[model samples]
Target: MGKITGFMEYERLQEASEEPQKRLKHYKEFTLHLNDADAKIQGARCMDCGIPFCNNGCPVNNIIPDWNDLVFHGDYQTALDTLHSTNNFPEFTGRICPAPCEAACTLGINEDPVGIKSIEHFIIDKGWENGWVKPQPAVVKTGKKVAVVGSGPAGMAAAQQLARVGHDVTVFEKNDRVGGLLRYGIPDFKMEKSHIDLRVKQMEAEGVTFRTGVFIGKDFPADIINWAKETISADQLNKDFDAVILTGGAEQPRDLPVPGRELKGVHYAMEFLPVQNKVNAGDKVKDQIMATGKHVIVIGGGDTGSDCVGTSNRHGAESVIQFELLPQPPEEENKPLVWPYWPTKLRTSSSHEEGCERDWAVATKRLEGKNGKVEKLIAARVEWKDGKMVEVPNSEFEMKADLVLLAMGFVSPVQSVLDAFGIEKDGRGNAKATTDGEGCYRTSVDKVFAAGDMRRGQSLVVWAIREGRQCAREVDAFLMGDSVLPR
Candidate 1:
């Protein structure tokens, strides 16, 4: 550790955020990064814990203590290097990841955790400002070709790793842009699209090809939502490339199959979120689903629902309300009982802080509307007993809702893509694959592999990156006799 007594001297200092009232006026990132001096102080807060559980807490297993010490000593370039060695996209995780690493911090047992995320944001931003993040093109070509489906974080990480190892990599995206969810699902207020664009440029410089608006399995019977200009068959991809990696995320959103679900105002969170992102990218969205002047009800208490709340507020909604089926968790977790592991606790996002009426243990019974449009939502208060929800008698209530957004999270990947390639599926319907031992990440079918949400079900960006990096190594080892890429 750079400072032995640093933890006792400094308290945790978070990055400053723009005033909610002012930030709602525009779709730009509001969180300010820590200055170098403040970042150093934060770095000094990292204790010389005999074992760094924070490393294991992170999905990508980042070397947190090393980077913290490096930053504390004012060696920012080395800190950036250490940070990037494990995680391919710290900027994305630093901004959006829930920071499980901090939850497992040794200091968090008694005091505040080290501001690891803020320090990471500072390091990555500094690296970009100093032009330290550049292309690391392979010196020699491997004379092999790889095809990566979906341009999400997983696909991006795999493509970069494979390209750096001298293989020809081409990333195919069904959307009009490179980033999959990062481009569409996330709001610009949380993370600007320019960050994705910069990484795309860097990957291109590293000899990875990006083909947008190209669907890999458009011929399937199921109608997949894509804006692809061309359709490529699974057989064609198999013949053209030595290896194919499926990274398309879980897109099958869990739907509320209740009365009036067919109402005009009811929609999936994906249907509403992508349109706003498109508008932010300067594209004119026709008949966009706007929450302006409407009583919006966002069902499901998760990140997506929180996003809906923030976007609705930005759209000038008359009111925004969110619902959760499960009971609210304790404000503070029992740290001793759940130390070194993610604990269940109440998490209020920035959107919730802005303005949102949140209710827990409330379930939507049905929707009542007229003229083929949703007007109100019927809900009930329920209690959990004997591992089941029992509705309370005389607890039925109705609320005005001009629009309803279902944000209950994804169920699985688009089935068509998996079926089109004749890939085997697990019990959960995700592409069946393992993460360890011989033939890791290899699908039942030959020469095809799966990673990210496509293989592991819906998950975090950091986990997706971890799966992608490991999948790339497996693919490399399968293609060649050996691989140098880390697991």
Candidate 2:
């Protein structure tokens, strides 16, 4: 540790950002990173705890203390290297990951946690600015070839690792562009797409090929998802590639099937979020769903719901309200009881700061509409009794809602892809695959592996990267009878 008593001397500092009103006008990232001196101060706050629980808390197990010490000593290049050792895309996690590491901080039992995420953001951005990040193309070419189906974080991480190990890798994406979810599902105001594009370029230089607008499954209708422009059969991929990894996202949106569910203005959060991304990318979208001047109601209280609130505010909506079925958590967690673990506590996102009315323990009963468009929402207060929701007596209410967005989260991956390949599925409809033992990450079908959302169900981007890296190792060993890649 660079400063033995630094944790006692320094308090945590957060990254600065634009005023919500000012930032609401444009679809660009608003949060700013910490400068060098501020970052060093933050790094110095890392305590000399014997066991680094923050590492275990992080999904990728980042070498947090090593990087913190390096940053405190002004050895930022080594800090960047240490940061990249376990995580393939720190920039993505730095921006979007809900840092469980902070929750598990040793100092956080009483004091503020170290600003680890901000330090990471600074380190990676510095690496980019100094051109330290480069293509690491393998010198010796292994004859093995791999097919990674999905260009999200998991697929990208797998492809990069395998390519660096001298294996020929190709990534297939059904969308017009790469970055399956990051390209479309995410709003630009949080993270710009250029980050994904830059990585794609680097991967290409490292001998990883990307095929966009190519669906490796049965044909879908023109109205469904990114609508496969071309189809590649699973049989063809099995024959061509030595191994295949399924890293596609969970895209099956959970639907709200109450009365008047088919109203024109009511849509899934995916149906609304992706249109703005496409428009931002200079592509013309058909019949775009906008929140401008409409009274909006977003259901489900999660990151996706928060995203809807932020996007709706940006669209100049008349009003935006979000509903949560669960009871509101306490404002702060009981640290003594939940230390070194993720705790259930109230968290308000930057989007909530921008403005959105939020209510908990409220469930939508039905939607009322006129002229084939939603006009209002009918809901009621709910109470948990004996582990079940029971509506409060005579607590029914109505609110004006010109548009409704269902942000209830995904159910599973689109079943068509799994069905086309005849891969077995878990009870939850995710790809059936183990995460440990001799056959880890290998699907029931030979030479076919699954990882990320496709295998483990919907999860954070950090988990996706971890699974991708590990799956790459398994696939490598399967092809060559051994592997030097890290687990």
Candidate 3:
């Protein structure tokens, strides 16, 4: 370790962000990255823990300490290289990932953990500023063609990996552009789309072909099929490519099946979130959903609910309230002992701080509206008994709500996509493909494989990238009887 006493001397520091009032006016990233000196200090805080649990803690298994040391020593290029050794896109993870690695840091046993995410952000930004990030085209061509359906992180990583290893790779997306959820689902304020554009350019230079606005399945959801400029049969893709990989996301949103569910003011979180994103991308949306001059109620207390809260605040909502079905988590100090592994504690997001009143253990009984437009909500307090939720007697309440957003989360991948390719599905309706042992990532179909949300269901971008990389290795081995790509 370059700085043996550094961890003891330096306290952990996080990146800074714009004040909520100032950042709320525009849809752009507000969090400021660490400068050279501050990043070095944060890097110094990484203790020389022999086991380095942070490595395994990361879904991509990023070499946290090596890059941390490199950043501390002012070798930014080396640090950037180390960061890219595993994670295909540090910029994405740096901005939005919850930093599970920090939770697993040995320093986090008592004191604060190292700011590994910030250091990573600094290294990648520096590399881009110095024009160090470049494409590496394969030197020799392999007489094999690979097809990756879905241009999300998982498909992107797999295509890039296979392209670097001399395979002719084609990535297909049903959307008008690439990046999938990153391009549409994520708020531009969290991560700008330019990052994805840059990566696409690099991948293009590396002999990867991206075909957007093309639906690869014969049958698709009506709303989804409308986004595609053209359609190609799955049988055609199977016939054309030597191997195929499905990396589509889980998109079937869980619905709130209470009274007044079909009211005009009620909408899925996906319906509400992506329209704003598209408008931010300069797409004109007809009859756009706006929270201005409205009292909005967002259901579910996870990231999607928080995102809805943030977006509503940006739309100048009159009042915003979020409800959670589970009891409120304890404060960090009062959290259970099984921590660091899985932190079950109160967590407040940046969106919550913008402007929101949050409640817990509240279940929606029904929604009341006037003239087919939702205007109020009826709910009751709930308590858990024997792992079952029971409503509290005489605890019913009513509230004004001009709009109700269902942010309860997705159920599974679109079954139509799986059925189109004749792939077996797990109980969760995800593409059934294992991640270990022989035939890993290979679906029941002869040469088709699966990864990311299509295989693992709804998950983080980091996990998607990991699945893509490992799936590429197995595909390589299956094609050539051996492979050199890292898992």
Candidate 4:
């Protein structure tokens, strides 16, 4: 409401990016941010609707309109504070989140939606630039100790919140560094590591202790449970510290079960993406998966597949083709029908624009190879009938594919971690934990609790953050017999 008729006077503006041709040459962030004046204009476009559907669209439930108005009025410090009140890491989401909030914007029904993501990005960058973002150590000590397993967004958020509430927080990460998938699975070009480093610094300053390179089950003996300030047997965690929260991410990747699946040139997207991220982080990966001078085929048509396309192009691949099992959607959604919701439309990613031959309604039937290495792919076209897919008899074809990447999504968290604690699992192999009533987020084992992908299955980073925050509130209440943290 800075400008009563701002929505009518101004149109939405999105951030620009470097051309795909020039950006494909290197692995670095290419999106140009909106300047302060431009960001204010975008913020002004917020109608401040009576009921903000964008809030419903956001998993984190960010106070979008409030912050938008604040930024429009040149009160950015307040805008930053409002933004952080809900989202733990705007920088992370600002860069990689799909921006479902924008899709659900009220303005989207008739006009372009406000550039909320860009304004968010601008608010945070300004916060950092102006030294407005800082760690706030708790004034009183609860002396309660909490153990958070895994160092992904959920674990990190839980640890930070618990520590800020005067609890002693220790984050155990099996990886060599913090940030979990954010550190490895995501390429630096999409998000530079410095953003994560800054948060780690803030968390450390806020009294959150991080123990990396220590796999709980592998590095620590079962008997070492007694050494903790409060020994919680995986069963005792059900009884011991004030409480234990498991926030490990989902890592069980879906695989292609087909002929020649075990060939050398075929690998999972996780296997390939992490090595490049490591190399970008200065770690030498011997015998890295290189797409240079090869015909690369990426299976699956989601973000991971798009990531594979980008990585392949960066490695100077001779040719790259992406495949999707579903039929191609229309280039433009029917706005009249799908307004304010994620629509079923053809979506082109920045990587796809770089250079990729995309095909839909196609299925890989088999892998044809020689000498224990993938050399080509055999595929077929299929059409959907009723609720099933039927293959077209005459559409079988073969294409050269020196390298194949299975970009199919993850299935669940590694079961070994859950099994080690003797926690019950849901039908999907995720830790069985409820989110309401007594003992919310509490496992069947007692004081032990779970959150994030480990508890809710594989999901977005924003959802993970939400789970972490909510789980921390539950843990805090269980410890103090009461709590003030929001759910």
Best by lDDT: 1
Model 3, C-alpha of 152: deviation from truth (Å): 0.8
Residue pairs whose backbone atoms clash in candidate 4: 232-236, 232-237, 233-236, 236-239, 238-447
**Candidates by lDDT, descending order:** 1, 2, 3, 4
lDDT tens per residue, model 2, 72-150: 9999999999998999898999898899898888988899999888988999999999999999999999989999999
**lDDT for every model?**
0.93, 0.92, 0.91, 0.87
Model 3 reaches what TM-score against the true structure?
A: 0.98
Clashes of each: 0, 0, 0, 5
- TM-scores of the candidates are 0.99, 0.99, 0.98, 0.95
Residue-level lDDT tens digits of model 3 in 367-400? 9898999999999999999999999999999999
Where model 4 places Cα greater than 4 Å from the true spot, the runs are 218-240
In angstroms, the error of model 2 at 88 is 0.9
Regions more than 4 Å wrong, model 2: 219-224
Give the per-residue lDDT digits (tens) of candidate 1, residues 377-445: 999999999999999999999999999999999999988889889999999999999998889999998
Q: Return model 4's CA RMSD, one decimal.
A: 3.8
Q: RMSD (Cα, Å) of candidate 3?
A: 1.2
